[model samples]
Target: MTAVLSRGRSDAPVRSVPGRPAPRRRPTVAPTWFLLPALVVYALVVLYPSLAGSVLAFTDRSGFDPGEWVGLANFEKLLRDDAARAALTNTVAVAVVITVVQTTLGLLLALALNSAIRARNLMRTLFFAPMMLSPIIVGLLWQYIYTPGGPLDSTLEGLGLGFLTRSWLGSDGALWAIVASIIWHHVGIVMAIYLAGLQSIPPELTEAAQVDGAGAVRRFWYVTRPLLGQSTTIVIALTLTASFKLFDQMFVMTGGGPGVSTQTLSLVMYQQAFVYGEYGYGTAIALVLTMIVAAVVFVQLSITRRGEHQV
Candidate 1:
């Protein structure tokens, strides 16, 4: 009996059962099903519209009047048109100015807010509040401020600086006014993003730098800026995209006025396609705008990606 018991114990498995592997569970099909709704919606909403728009852009469709294929005639006209050329120039100028100015201001704001202060949270909220307003609403609000006898003019007059007041909504001043408003409105958003990035960084690194006799400027230049590579990339991309799509501010504040001085590609597209009756031409301009934005953004992304790897 003792020998039989010893043999049984010896033959036992070290772990659990030789009872057989759990029935190979069939692979779940949920992943495929999970993606089905979004794919279906995208096909209907985005893919179809994009394809149809591309096709429409090839023809000379004057509003509801459909015409035969004009090949690249619309694009040829777009290049030749002076209005389009001016709009393109204005758009580029606004984008470049806003990106640079807004980015610098945002970084400084972020750095300021990251420090300890009594009203830091309040200031953050106040700064961010403007960004939360709708662009159209903001534009409308600024129009009142920009119009003659508005608060801005009143303030100038009150300060005995009335000579500085100009027709902000008219002439080239309109463009500058819009740019200033945009910077003021959106700088907070960029600051918030950078603040988040700053918070994610380890405090010990900056503390260590301080111990090593690094001053504020030098420490930020050497340590903080390099580590903020991702944040900077995000700010640039967002500002670039926003500036390229500029419409609401120009539309409400100046109506692209002082005779097209503030006209942008997006505003031109809207006017051509809907206001006037040149759908095909508008589509061509739209295509060009899309290509320019995509190309520039792609180049920027590539450069940033390379820099990220180096960092």
Candidate 2:
């Protein structure tokens, strides 16, 4: 017993072997500390500007000076103006179309890619390439495509479908065309998100359903869809927010032109502030837009959370 006790005491410490050094300990930064940089930047860039805009909404400040106090006047004008009303309606319609179309197409693509296919990695890269391009650049490229007698029209003519070709940017269909371009650029990201979700799902679940005599559609509906609740929430939320902030494509392609047809809230906000020099009114418009976006995100998240719990 005394010899065992002596041996235990001798081996108590982790002594390094001769000719070999101790293993190096990895250094890890605290999670809170990692967030410091982003928090500071957001405070300076987004938070401060938003607060200043809110305060300026009350006063009619035209960029240079703090002008007269006008309580609810800006909001009053915003409510009664026909242009503002039209802009709001267009904004809502475009957002809905973009959210639905983008999510559906993206989900389909994700499902297709998740299956065994030839050159799947190459296809993924090609699809995701457009998403990596600048929004402005995308707007610019689509501008040429939608231009009168441009590539789109040429392609239609070549296909003997010239009757379907028209001035996309110059007509009533301009907004939807812009939405299509946005979907093209962003649907890749949505697909990537869904692919991640599909990958995360356990193979055994699908296999079990198959063994139980469940058909393909039934298995997907009963097992896959419910499991993809979180991915659906993410795709919908991101696309909804992006739709509301619909500016770059509409701005570059149509310029809210042929009238106020394509004038989204963000586009109108820019025109009101920079083009017309109505800074206070523009700030007011921006504040309202921000609130609407925030409300949408909150409602979407809440609904999705409730659905997740129910599922």
Candidate 3:
């Protein structure tokens, strides 16, 4: 009887307690398999072309011929190329300026608007309106504004500042003009990101800082900015990458002219591949650009992550 009772107890079904449900096993494999179709499409559309282009970087294909492989020759030429070097310098300058200015201004705008104020919503919308416009449209608009006798010059002249006006898109100032337009066009997005981060921060933090006799600046330095590390990381990474690859607005506004003063790596790559039929060289430039962006972003993220951990 004792052996039979022990056997019966061992074979008894487990039951959930009253008012509770049994735990269900999650189908992890099934959920992962569901991602296969999208992954397949991404591989075909993005990865394949990228890999093919990278391979072509070693060959002398000119879009018309099955050209021979000339490993590292194009890269060697790139090292000696003056225009490529100049474009690289300009690209770095533009990226750094845009990243620094955009991030700072965005944070300022977010802080200003985060406070209770009249028509804050409307002001936010107005500030972000430029981000909604296409790059081409913004380019055209700024192009018109920067035209010698267009609104900008006319306004300056009308304000007795005619001496301040010059060839906005034709002189040394052309690069700066392009940089300014890009900043205006994309700063709104930066503002929006910072604003979201600001909103997500708890009000209790600020109030506690105030109770501890912290002033506005101190509160921001200690309470707000630290909490915004993730947002800053995201914003800086995005602006840095986008600024490096900037092509459309610059193309439309200056065509990298009066010379190569405003030319960036992307513009150079485009001109080489499609305009000059140097496909191999173009791909090589593209590969260099990809590597630079990846390396910079990786370093930036690592630094930001380390800072977050320290905080």
Model 1 regions lying over 4 Å from their true place: 1-33, 309-311
- Candidate 3 lDDT, tens digit per residue, 231-251? 899999999999889999889
**Minimal lDDT window, size 10, model 1:** 1-10
Among the numbered candidates, top TM-score falls to 3
Residues 1-311 of candidate 2 have per-residue lDDT tens digits of: 11211233433534444556754433456777989999999999999977876887787878687799998899888998788889999999998998999999999999999999999999999898999999899999999998889999999999999999988988888888888899999999999999998998999999999999999999889988888889999999999998998888888888898799998889888998898888889889988998999999999999986655222
> How well is each residue in 1-311 modelled by candidate 1, as lDDT tens digits?
11211224534433423454433334568789999999999999999998889876889999679977999999999989998999999999999999999999999999999999779999999999999999988998888998898899999999999999998888677898999999988999999999988998889989999999999999998889888888888899889988998999998888789898999999999999999989999999998998999887888777875554222
State model 1's lDDT: 0.88
- Which residue pairs collide, candidate 1? none
Best of the two (1, 3) by lDDT:
3
lDDT at residue 173 of model 2 (Cα atoms)? 86
- Residue 37, candidate 3: Cα error in Å is 1.0
lDDT at 48, model 1: 95
Better of 1 and 3 by TM-score: 3
**Model 3: worst 10 consecutive residues (lDDT sum):** 1-10
Q: How close is candidate 3 to the true structure, as a TM-score?
A: 0.90
- Top-lDDT candidate index: 3
lDDT: the better of candidates 2 and 3: 3
Off by over 4 Å in 3: 1-27, 309-311
